[model samples]
Target: MKFMAKIELSRHIPLVTLIVLVLCITPPIFATKNCDFPAIFSFGASNVDTGGLAAAFRAPPSPYGETYFHRSTGRFSDGRIILDFIARSFRLPYLSPYLNSLGSNFTHGANFASGGSTINIPKSILPNGKLSPFSLQIQYIQFKEFISKTKLIRDQGGVFATLIPKEDYFSKALYIFDIGQNDLTIGFFGNKTIQQVNATVPDIVNNYIENIKNIYNLGARSFWIHGTGPKGCAPVILANFPSAIKDSYGCAKQYNEVSQYFNFKLKEALAELRSNLSSAAITYVDIYTPKYSLFTNPEKYGFELPFVACCGYGGEYNIGVGCGASININGTKIVAGSCKNPSTRIIWDGVHYTEAANEIVFSQILTGVFNDPPISLDRACYRK
Candidate 1:
């Protein structure tokens, strides 16, 4: 019996070795065969806003879209933003701002993002204020209204109906959220200390989670949420906090810490959401990592002058708080002009990113490396 057992074990050894070899050679499958998201519904602030704020208020003047469209498209960047690249990746048309009714098409998706938007309702503002009136709550309400109104328009059936997306598209579409940076900045610039600003993160994240839940209830199943970028690295923050301690990369240390803390809390909140909304595929994209890398190692990415604004007036960082517009400096009005080559720079207006930088960010985040659950943009709809 012992001799027979030894012979049987030896016979199975080749099978075990073959199994191990197959496992080593073949790549592991992290997600289901790529999901076919029918459309995309986006929400956020300037980082992703196509033209919502411009439609509601005044459009950003010349030099804003000079790189691509050869005219102002209201985007804060010199050319296209990340949303534009994302739409193109899926072979879908650029998202039309919900507020833009003129020459707008919403067959694929709609953008509810507006410049200066916040996750929570901002304090009341005066006329032509910098902060936007469209908070995350307001955007949620608009999305809810959009669903009902579009369904009604499609039911009527006409030339207008052709512009509306089908009813099933809502549940099948990808939902992206890229707001929250303004929430941190508002506190810091409003005379609040770093500690004071950090204290508000929990409430702010709670409000953000509530809105995500609200949208989920309205049939949103796939979510891609971006954490705030490194505001400390931007020229605007560095200029405002000239006295603050700077990191090796020349970014304000305290401000970036605040951003990281917010991301930590936001990630914990999202974990809870995953459990609560079992059917939903929630992806937490770490945009901060790749973005900060651009500043830390700009040469590796074919970028130069990572912290300096490409389109701004005079300053240590080539920014005078104005880009593509005229600003008064020392009693003299000067126009913040574009650089000779925006493709070589990271910062665009001291507040937003350039088209080149935005493209790099999108490319990195589209890979599974920066995403929670390690799912790429094409696999965002699949549950891990």
Candidate 2:
């Protein structure tokens, strides 16, 4: 029997060697498929805010979640932000805001956006004093760093930890950005012409590109950047416009034109980023069109009042003059009210969209949700 075994080994030695070589040289084809490991990072503002600022500010019951929370959760809308809907759609747990202490689980993700936050630091306003800027929010997120090397929270099963060991930044994570609107609004108010705004656009894009790259350096691979909606048609901005006559569609032609230009330029920049940074996956959603559509055809869209919010008094829809709640002015009780059906309307207030509208937008984004498709950090990272 020993002799027979020796003869067999000698005859099949080459075949055995070939099998070993194949196992070492080629990986299983199925292993390279989708990585549904779940997302871990998010960045954006009130549009996607999951009740971040609402907890910090103080106001009467009238100024808060009257339509939903029946009080305030700190979120300045009728109900949830866009981020909440997206997370829910993805089957991930609801996200928690960075500055607050409401949520304990960091395994899923965290929302670093604050209400009244602008991409430009020190450039935001809220009912409760100044708001957090994009730069500041980024700083705040760094502390609770989700990177492997800077792991503030470790996993028992080493799920998130294994992907990004201590100090490793770019594990299986997704970074989102819903910005640029405030920059345009502030620029418009600051005497900057559209041409001037256009001039600054490139620099802003470059800075954002650089910032995203920095996030990539920290280990983020998936990115979702947003475009501005028809800013010219925002209820309050229209009130601010001194010259243009309102088109029945509620679209301020000039303002919409500016938004159009920004989207065009931003599109080009995003395309360039995708092509140049093929290693990182970057996805851009056209929030401008869908959001603008709600305003353009409010009636068709089941919106009874498009120009004014449901939570304000009088026709002007001014929150300070008794909006969000019914305030007592000089002993005279003032009260604002929500619409009959918030689900049908889009704008929650003069400047923001309602939960209903957010759901609508989220559905639209779902059709082409972009991110690192399980691999190729270079293609999905959005950073060169």
Best by TM-score: 1
How close is each model in CA RMSD to the real structure?
5.3, 7.1
lDDT of 2 by residue, 290-356 (tens): 7777777777667766766656665554433435556676998766766677777666777787777
The number of clashing residue pairs in model 1 is: 0
TM-score, every prediction: 0.91, 0.76
What lDDT does each candidate get? 0.91, 0.63
- Candidate 2 has a TM-score of 0.76
Model 2, residue 185: what's the lDDT? 71
lDDT of 1 by residue, 1-384 (tens): 999996787677897786787788787775336777778999999999999999998788878987887788889999999999999999999899999989999999899999989998989542456789999999999999999999899889999999988899999999999999999999998999999999999999999999999999999999999999998998999998999899998999999999999999998999889988999999999999999999999999899988889988888998865776787769998778899999999988898998999999999999979778888999998877
TM-score of 1: 0.91
Q: What overall lDDT, based on C-alpha atoms, would model 2 receive against the true structure?
A: 0.63
What does the lDDT come to for candidate 1? Answer: 0.91
